[model samples]
Target: MTTIERELHIEASPEIVYEVLTSPEHLVKWWPDEAKVSLAPGEPGTIAFLPDYPSVPLTVDEAIPVSRFAFTWAEDLQVTFTLTPSGTGTLVRFVESGHADAAGHAENVRGWDHFLPRLVEYVPTTVAA
Candidate 1:
């Protein structure tokens, strides 16, 4: 059971960050061109970069507004996102479990490093207004 964790700080409130992270419409703004996530929490979501990786369909397991969201792509691969309010900003914590091997972990880490920066850019400046 390998695990990878990452943290990102955005200049937006937790509520706004959570919405951008969980909603498909907003996800498209930050997610890579190769990535596509359909649906949102409490419904269904899928993470994939077709032709390069397997399409891992998922169902949202739990969601608590601006606090936490968890989903299972497979019985073993579970992903969770946690948002914490931090001094006028939001702390985003991402955890992924059950990478079968080093390659899988590396791929995921690289993918996030590529997209997470975009998320920071997408954080609405109007949040404080």
Candidate 2:
């Protein structure tokens, strides 16, 4: 399985980071074109892009509050977000695994790089407010 992984340092606490990561409102701000997510494991969420597009599904695989959040996204790929308390901030190790091909792998790698910085930038502002 091809895996895409990246680490981001967000200037916020782990609890804050996890909240932004799992919350539906915050997720829409940073990921997908739109999302409706529930953070509990075994519960499913829906994602949609354009009006003509069908909603895609996502399901939480594991969630351990401020420590780990993982889910199955886009049918096959598994995304795991691990939060570590670093200094006064958080180190988020983001991973998506089980790509079916190299192109899909590369795209998702680019995808995470594109989206995670949004999380880094968005977290502190919201958490501080």
Question: Runs in model 1 with CA error above 4 Å?
Answer: 32-43, 50-54, 125-129
lDDT of 1 at 40: 55
lDDT values for all models: 0.75, 0.87
The number of the candidate with the highest TM-score is 2
TM-scores of the models, in the given order?
Answer: 0.79, 0.92
Per-residue CA lDDT of candidate 1, range 15-118, in tens?
Answer: 89888866766766777333344435556556655456456567777778899978777446788889999987988898988899898788878877887888
C-alpha RMSD in Å of predicted model 2 compared with the true structure: 1.5
**Worst lDDT window (10 residues) for model 2?**
45-54
Top-scoring candidate (lDDT): 2
